[model samples]
Target chain A: MSAALKLVDAPRRSVALEVRGVSHAFDLGGKHLPVLDNIDLSVAPGEFVALLGPSGCGKSTLLRLVAGLEQPDVGALLEDGAPITAPDPSRILVFQDPTLFPWRTVWKNVAVGLEARGLLPAHKQRVADALSLVRLEAFAQAYPHQLSGGMAQRAALARALVNDPHLLLLDEPLGKLDSLTRLAMQNELVSLWQKVGFTALLVTHDVEEALLLADRVIVLSDRPARIVTEFLIDKPRPRRRDDADLVHLRQTILATLGPVHD
Target chain B: MSDIAQGGAVRTVASVPIWRDGVAAAAAWFVAAIVTVATPDVVPWGSTPLWAEILTGGAVLLLVLSGTVQWLGRVGRVVVHYGPWLVALGVWFAVWEVVTAKTGWLPKPFFSPPQGLLHVYLVDTTRLGLCVLFSLRLWAYGFGSGVIAGFLVGVALGWSKRFAYWGMPILKLIGPVPATAWIPCTFFILPTTFSASVFLVALASGIPVAILTASGVGSVNRAFYDVARTLGASERFLVWRVAVPASLPHVFVGLFMGLYYSFAVLVVAEMLGAKYGLGWYLQFQTGYSAYANVYATLVIMALLTSGLVKLLFVTRDRVLSWQKGII
Candidate 1:
């Protein structure tokens, strides 16, 4: 109900994201370990895209690059045609863990971005709006430990949403959640994106999840990952997991990732 | 993890009925009072009418509290918790009185009855009061300045690698040496004995805090820093908001250690060249072998130090309330 939360009908200024020839590697005790291979992708403003890959296929590393927490060694990431150099409040990343500051309450955790930018005083109401957006208003003062897994993840989402980010990079944000919570949050995520209209790039290992949530799903190969295939899902909002088309897409995507051991 | 089970567990811890422990405590205290008044000392240690009165009064008060404490709400809960301790204290007091004054088993000058301690309290209240005030003043100044300096130095060492590179080796070298070991040098360096004593207390307290704080800050989860950075937090923000809060549990560990060290150094330092501290009073009384005064001062010192420790605990609970159940 707060002013910061735009109605679904209202126009939102989400940013266009461009990743060009991005390649990155980590040094593991003096040995070169490649994670992300040369990868190029672009997301339209207000679009929802999911990157699907095998576990440890550099999907999260790619999200980190897009978040500007780390720079890709080979290429540039841009937001709205401007090169991403440093982490900005406009581009927020939600990790697998809630990572809520244990010392802070849910409300305080959500206010971190605004507080860090010195804008909390002027926009305190946004924190409350963000909490309620994720249906966490009743637990605004509760500590992270007091919250259930789903509630804590919701609080983490609110922490990102409070900044009114243009692009949200989700690095398997619901990976640690139970299946029931994950399904509920997947619906919540879709509705939230529709309402806030942020350009979202989600990195997920679940093919069904990618198929269920994203307008477009980009599949990458195993470690030193490069884009292997892309799928365009024209399904309507509130798409069902069992829908024939989604089931077909899931199977095809899984097939492309090669045989699953599990 | 089940809330219902946890609630049941709590509900099962039933409060003692009829206040049996309280009654026992009152009975012991009454016996102590009777023995002090009715029996003559083996060697007429001192007239202790006031001590007898106090014991009688305490017994009567305990008896009354036993009857009425159930109606006192929160205070009653606290009384119930310490019921066993109260009973032990009463029994201990009676036994102590019998051995020292009634039988003279623990002979003169070497040991005194409880009332001999009480007699010291009644006669030398002014001197003890002055000593208490002076000791507290020195302790406050030393502990305050030392904690502050240590916290700053620790933060610097923790946050900046450059600072740690130069500071850590020096800290390792100096930290192990006893604060008292510097006493001779400190007296020569500082202009006054008071300053020297303060310096010793500060050194004893500061080193532990600095060492623990540095380690605490160093060991904070790196993920927290990453999370803060991605949230648009500045370098300063990361250090103050993320690093400091995350390291607080460790800092508190340091603080507790510092508190104990500070107290030990305070007593030792006061013994050196002070004019009017509890430590000074202890030394002065011992010189004359006024064992009664020394015993009374030791009791006061025990109460003061424990009171400070309890105060620190209260402060810690308030500051770290967020961490109540989590860690």
Candidate 2:
């Protein structure tokens, strides 16, 4: 635990992850299906960035490219000034399904990413600490089937954090939860980010969630998607949902997204 | 003052005694026995004595009585547990005895009394045991090989698009052909009778399993694979650790089906060519006109098939316990 604390003292001021003119497409029966178009973004060390868009706008695609799950057809993504060509444990992605191995209990599921990277033995304490941070200590031995949606997502978060990834990529991690659970998880995520001080890049369609959680929200255009707008939230930590300033920001984003009835 | 209580009690009185069904059944049996004895020559088969005829009638009556009791006592847990099984056994024995002994539809020399068959079973326990052991050995070898080979092939085909595209069509074309049809070719190609049996059973069983495993692999959530890829899992880890584990429920279903298929194919294979095993013993008994032994062998095969199927279910429960509600 103290060793992880050492990361906090390491200049806390360098660029953690960078996306430079990254673009991607899929092969659709000899036709190019453009997904993300020349997306360029950067997140400073310990900054929380959100890529917000409508469905099929390739917010998730951008996250995948940055995480190095899919190589961009053009340009490059870099982490700590190194060119990203393949996935690395330094950038871990938290998925919507929690995707915890059903056969493994909560503790084992959290430990898998570390184990996959061959870091479990040295980081076992860190894993436990992360699980405790998620308030899942009592459910450490419970199977994924036994967990509610929120609990499973918490375990997924714990798994990503156990590796002490420099960039924590979230692909709509709370999108599947009910409204009440989603709000609670949003608060938990922001608080955890504050405590851990890790750089985060979240992909979400919910404008409010993006406004509440991100330091900067990057909105993408529909299909052949590219960055369309960027908003910086200057509100202080633990901002309330009912905060007038936050509501104003949300309305501004909705306006940028276009007619709500349509 | 007590007159009202007495009137109410009379209104609430129970309908009949519990043994009323048994009593009625006994009377019906007596009538049937009288009719059967009076017309023995006209009976479908005349081998059974008048006394045996009466006993068979009584057994049928008892079966009906027990069935009625089970229906009436459906709410009672104890009756629910044991009643249906008792009635089923009684009915089965009665029908079997009547068909073979009281009816001449079957060849006379090839039929035996149920008591005579039971006596032969108890007396020749050693031979029966040996036959069971031989049949089980073949079953185990064939089923085990089929399941392992099917899962391996399934995973390979599932993990790679290239493999699936080329291999799946070929497997589909060949899978539907019955295993029994391969007996003649195997007889000449294989060195031993048992090897042929094993090979035929495995071939028959593995096709369905491979198809099932591939389908299972194809159905794994695309998101999970993306997550694995994003997490920096190697290609090997993705296939074995992620893809295979994800597709396990499908694999189990394939294995279960394979087990049953192998057992059926094993019997057919053994009967056709093998020198030893339950199927061979059945053939030998039929040729010698020992109809009771043939019936006994058939019963043994049924029991073995049921036991093996149960074992498959138990193994499935253990392996896929993770997938209880996921489907």
> Cα miss at B98, model 1 (Å)?
2.0
- DockQ value for model 1: 0.66
The alpha-carbon lDDT assigned to residue B32 of candidate 2 equals 45
Residue-wise lDDT of candidate 2 within B1-327, one digit each (tens)? Answer: 354576754453344334444544454455444443543432243333544565556656564554455455645446445544545554554555555555645445677545446655776689988988998898778877877788888887888889888998888888888888888999889998888898888887788789888988888888777766666667787788788888888887787778777877888888888777898888887898877788778778888888878887898898777777776
Which candidate gets the maximum lDDT versus the true structure? Answer: 1
- Model 1 C-alpha lDDT versus the unseen true structure: 0.89
* Prediction 1 TM-score vs. true: 0.94
Fnat per model, in the order given?
A: 0.81, 0.51
List the global CA lDDT of all models: 0.89, 0.77
Query: Model 2 chain B, poorest ten-residue lDDT window?
Result: B39-48
State how far residue A27 of model 1 sits from its true place (Å): 0.9
Second chain alone, TM-score for each candidate? 0.91, 0.73
DockQ class, candidate 2: medium
